[model samples]
Target: MAAKGQEFFEEQRDQSLVKAHIVSKYFDAWSNVMLGVRKQYGRIDKLAYIDLFCGPGRYTDGSKSTPIMVLEHAIKNPELASLLVTMFNDKDEANISSLREAVGALGGVGSLKHAPQIHCSEVDRDAEEMFAKTNLCPTFSFVDPFGYKGLSSRFIHAMVKDWGCDCVFFFNYGRINAGITNSYVERHMDALFGRERAEKMRGFVRTMNPRQREIYILEELAGALKDLGARFVLPFRFKRGDGHRTSHALIFVTKDFRGYAIMKDIMARESSTEDEGVPSFAYSPAEADTPLLFSLSQPLSALKGDLLKSYAGRTLTMLQIYEDHNVDKPYIAKNYKAALNELEEQGQIVANKPAAKRPMKNGQRTFSDATLVKFPALEK
Candidate 1:
């Protein structure tokens, strides 16, 4: 199975539009974090990029992999041109050779400003051990495994325990669903969720259908990540081309709200572009075949209602609203502005700020802590 997986990847290196989209989103998120860190810290002494399942440099179609993408971004962006350390690990020596060749073709690390250190190792190292040897510099690690063998809650806990370290990992939902009933896979399940939780989950979802089972497992994984100290966990679902079932989920775990907000924005933008108005966070392949009245405005309207209902007859500053709702599930500060605008249009809320007669959108009006927002009086 492993050999076939590698062969398939090599053969279709340039194929899989789904993978292309996923990788593009990954690159976007990674770039955002790098730039954000630089902007936040002024000048980071060192930044680390680690890819556990680093593939060959280019796909068959000549597209760059994650490592190449990282290097290109660092070279292009002045802020990220500072001291950088990148480690690419893969079990296959051929993949390491290909990645080295690809880096060399791109002019190698010497082409960068700081002469970034690049490490390509063909070893079986897990996240826990890799993180143990890592320096105190801020690190972003990408964990994309073929299955859930080496990934454990304990390892994830250790990775995020350090300040300024975040992770993006691929969770194979299909594989888990398929192997849920197999006794031989029990050990892996135990390692993934911890033995006690795994047994409890197995018993809980034993009678669920495949879809239900997958959802339960995903929820459990997200919960485990939270328990392990990830302040923000966002799961981006990827579906097969047919849009019948999910193939896998890209889970982003971070310790900072800014990182969470950045990823949320990226996922929303990418999914909306691909799904045509349906945000990736709210998309389901099973419902893809059936059409419903879903539009870009629907989310805004819903947000407006939710905010009004939650804070009726109360006043809050724009910052307060964002702080309360930005980190909430299915909604971010980006969604709050539109909802607030819509509420003002309907007289459901009033914005009390200088020259704020009209609803604010984007740069038209800036939200501040002193800006008062009063919801309409609740009926007696």
Candidate 2:
């Protein structure tokens, strides 16, 4: 039998499909944004997409994976055709061979300015060292290791240190949860969370229930990334097919809040449920049993209270509030607008458009990015 995770290459699964779509979609949007920048500034000439554990280009079920999806999208866009640089790596020689064949057979591969770079090398500490020394262009790197062996904070940091660089890695949370206290995987855990933090995490999670443990670990990982200068970090959880437990997650790391905002919107759209317009940022299969509905109101209510308290006595435009408050939060721009609108209706806050501007939607005055909002201070 094939090793774990290799089976998915044989036949794509639902979670894999979701993950691939999210990555490809983000790349499409991100590249377009970069293209716009290039046109305006004439400085950004090349964009790169690196996939460290890219599988065979096509699954046994005849479905294209992320590498092909990204290339296909780029091929269609003339600007991306000249500006994009693609790279794919897999340690398995067989997989590499298969990907080479599939890519060679692509309809428009010949039109790309830079041919895709394919490599078969084990990604580990040496690879991390190489990345640290290399100068990367504005790049989006995807690191999707089978378990946790080839993934490290240092490696991810190196990939995103340059300007306009961002990373998304497959976080095998289930393996990590079990491996935390396992002596055999201790070194790997140390590499991922750093030695000091990993040691503390092991003891801290001893008493935490599974839900609490999951939250704590993810927060710690995000903290670690932040400590390494990744200003924004977000996670999209993927639950097991049974919808009972988390199998893994895709964590995005970036220095730019704009990238963070773009990814936030993408993940929000992919989320299985949006409770009160607030996305759960997770994907799980629908369960057979009827689910509870009362808790949905809590998110908007909490957001309203949080915004009122956080911005008390301050007046700022809707865009300003979103840019200032959206880092590391799951509430997208719409959720913020909804919360602010409700606050205005309840007389808890004041939202107004500029005198010189009138923004309307469907013949109704609308709260736009330029709309000014003022929150009254809390009572003493």
Candidate 3:
């Protein structure tokens, strides 16, 4: 293990806390969704959570890590404790040992039907190949490597191949942003983005500015995952503590749109700021009032315009419009609701509510998924 790895656990930094919160919270919600499906449909019998580079259970500052939080969540939910299986692995023996001790110290470890499995193995080609060949339970894998050595599209594709399987991996943007141009790290970069795309990106990014480079790189990565049958890739950015630049991001990948939508809402809640009701989708220490040189803002006015133009003369439920438009979109359902409500109020569109009043939220009328919206046709 490198000194950087050691320094990471010395104290849980602010970014680390955000990262942990995003992962654990997603896992909790994911479990509940899966559990509900199992109870209603009985299509799934087990759900698995695998952490490829799980670290020691606690930071030197005594803050619990994701593994411990995961266990705690499962232990508290009797339904989840019975069906959720966990596997945690780290190349470092010391981390595995510390994790074992930490897991043992948890309050309800004994309640779990299946004990958490711990493994000490390097996450290299062998691990990737093993996962690709084996059939995994509906699994959620978290891959957090020290750098980008063991993380690859092949491994990620394998992790999300099975039904209900999804993955969240750490994208080391700082290292990658530098590595794209450096000849030394070319092999790892190729493995991540595929050989041809990586070579193409290296040349493509040369003429681009910093912001353009970031967007292009992420789009390329998302494209690669989509090509390999893993659709619905979402990234959550983490800025350096100084807020000068982005350090890394957590990329969520899955084949299902429901998983994608669930994660999007979760990420939106954790975002640092919103512009005109649209989330920034980043974590930065800079004050919310600070002016930015570049910002990606999707105002409600723009959304309303888009909806009117795109769905002119068509009658569709709010859910249908959101489902069709939300892919690769920064706007969440709330933004959609706000825009739709404004359009209805202004007589730009007709919103038909259910005959029976739907449940009121915050004691105010709002558009439910079933609300029928009709947009006026474009001017002839």
Each prediction's whole-model lDDT (CA): 0.67, 0.87, 0.86
Clashes of each: 2, 0, 0
Each candidate structure's TM-score, on Cα atoms with residue i matched to residue i, is 0.81, 0.92, 0.91
Cα lDDT for residue 114, candidate 3 = 93
lDDT of 3 by residue, 18-79 (tens): 78988998898888888888989998878999998999989777889999999999999998
Model 2, 74-126: lDDT tens digits are 89988899989999999999889989999999999988999999999999889
Structure candidate 1, residue pairs in collision: 13-60, 14-60
Q: Is candidate 1 or candidate 3 better by TM-score?
A: 3
Model 2 whole-model lDDT (C-alpha atoms): 0.87
Higher-scoring candidate on TM-score, 1 or 2: 2
Model 3: pairs clashing at backbone N, Cα or C within 3 Å: none
Best by lDDT: 2
RMSD to native, candidate 1: 5.0
As a TM-score, model 3 comes out at 0.91
Predictions: Cα RMSD each: 5.0, 3.5, 3.8
Candidates ranked by lDDT: 2, 3, 1
